[model samples]
Target chain A: EAGVAQSPRYKIIEKRQSVAFWCNPISGHATLYWYQQILGQGPKLLIQFQNNGVVDDSQLPKDRFSAERLKGVDSTLKIQPAKLEDSAVYLCASSSNTQGANVLTFGAGSRLTVL
Target chain B: QKEVEQDPGPLSVPEGAIVSLNCTYSNSAFQYFMWYRQYSRKGPELLMYTYSSGNKEDGRFTAQVDKSSKYISLFIRDSQPSDSATYLCASTLYSGAGSYQLTFGKGTKLSVIP
Candidate 1:
């Protein structure tokens, strides 16, 4: 089975600019997640989607970040007016909604650089 | 205090040695524990998963969860150069309806030198 797919593996933009990353989860997977990994830190949850509806996004910086999963398949995470702190790797992951399962399959991730 | 704490070590060990990694958590509600390995510039992949507390071993890797002390450990025996990567410890409540949040430690970097 194909793993989760993310596009624009590397992106460079000036601070205060806008950037968007895309993710295509594995087939039959119902849970999709967006995580940010700053250098020397673990991936932090930015948003989570179960099917087409959001399950959690409390850690998401709403004022500058927005995400959507349309039709419950594909997802997009956008950061507007990016900050220097936004220079990090954006990872997309998916997992089957099997009862009591939490294993997540991840994409290669999109690396972002804010200059 | 953070929900989870891990030592961010660029720990170096000779090949064929034993490696021990650990993380401590503050939430007793986390009943599921996991260890993920991530290479440079790559996303993390699950290496082990444990339900509640106990020891689960897979080949050269062992995962131990002690809910009583809120501490978890991952041990790699006869470590190889291939084992060089960052190991992250994560814990969460059972992934079910209305509760899917995963709390992760900062991650420990391990290198097995040949």
Candidate 2:
């Protein structure tokens, strides 16, 4: 089966600019997640979607970031007016929502650089 | 204190050696534990998963979880060069509702030299 897919393997943008990343999760997977992995740290959850509805997004920066997972198949995470601190790898992962089973399959994240 | 604590080791070892990675958590509510391997420039992949306190073995990897001590470990037997990567320890949230949130450690970098 195909793994989770992310576009723009790498991205570079200036501060205050806007950037968007897309993710296509594995087929049959109902849970999608967006995470930010800063250098020297583990990925932190930005948003989570169970099918088309959001399950959690408490960590998301609502003022500068927004995400959507319409139709419950694909997802997009956008960061507007990117800041220097936003330079990090954005990862998308998916799981089968088997309840008690949350082993995530990750994509080859999109690396972002804010200059 | 952080929910999970891990030593960030750029640990280098020769091939065929045993590597032990560990993490400590303060939340006794964490019932599900996991270890993920992440390559440079890539996302993390689950290497092991275990519930509560016990040991689970798969191939050359062993995952041990001790809820009493709030400690978890991943042991790689006969490590290979390809196994060199960053290992992250994560604990699931208390809610059983589809097992939503996860708190991860800073990750330990391991290098296996051939």
Candidate 3:
């Protein structure tokens, strides 16, 4: 099976600029997640979508970070006015089921660097 | 205290050696324990998953969880250079809305020398 897919393998921008990353989950998967991983740190959940509706976004920096999974298939994460601290790898993951452990399949992340 | 705590070790070991990675969590609600392996510049892949406290083994890897102590571990036997990567420990529980919240520990970087 094809794994989750992400676009713009790498990006660089100055602080206060904006950037967006795209993700395509595995076929038939119903759940999608966006996670941010800083250098040397574990990935942190930025948002989660069950189909097209949001399941969680408590960790997202609403003022600067936004994500949407439209039509319940592909997702886009945007960072406006990016800060130096916002530089990190954006990972996309998907799961077929929500029951039990719900093992996730992840994509090679989109790396972002904010100067 | 952090929800999950792990020592970020750039641990190095030679081939055919035994490697052990561990983590601790403070959340008792976490019912699922998992281990994920992440190569550089890539996303994490599931290495092991265990629900109940005990031991589960798969090929050259063993996963151990102790619910009472809120501890989890992964052991690699006959380690090879291919086993070198960052190991992340994660814990999760049902969080309503048909979703679960997974919390991860700081990954331990392992290097296996052949």
In order, how many clashes per candidate?
A: 0, 0, 0
Worst 10 residues of 1 chain A by lDDT: A95-104
Better of 2 and 3 by TM-score: 3
Candidate 1 local lDDT, A1-115, one digit each (tens): 9999999999999999999999999998888999999999999999999999988898999999999999999999999989999999999999885746478889999999999
**Candidate with maximal DockQ:** 3
Off by over 4 Å in 3: none
Over B50-85, each residue of candidate 3 has an lDDT whose tens digit, in order, gives 999999999999999999888899999999999999
Model 3 over residues A85-107: C-alpha lDDT tens digits? 99899999999774689888899
Q: Write the per-residue lDDT of candidate 2 for residues B1-114, one digit (tens) a residue.
A: 889999999899999999999999998777689999998877898887999688999999999988888889999999999999999999887333464677889999999999
Of the pair 1 and 2, which is ahead by TM-score?
1
Please list all clashing residue pairs in model 2, or write none if there are none.
none
TM-score of chain B of each: 0.95, 0.95, 0.98
Which stretches in model 1 have alpha-carbon errors above 4 Å? Answer: B94-99
- Cα lDDT tens digits, model 1, B67-99, are 899999999999999999999999876545644
Interface RMSD of 2: 1.8
Q: What's the i-RMS for candidate 3 in angstroms?
A: 0.9
**How much does each candidate deviate from the true structure in C-alpha RMSD?**
1.2, 1.4, 0.9
Off by over 4 Å in 2: B94-99
Model 3 gets an lDDT of 0.93
Q: For model 3, name the residue pairs that clash.
A: none
Q: Chain A in model 1: its TM-score?
A: 0.98
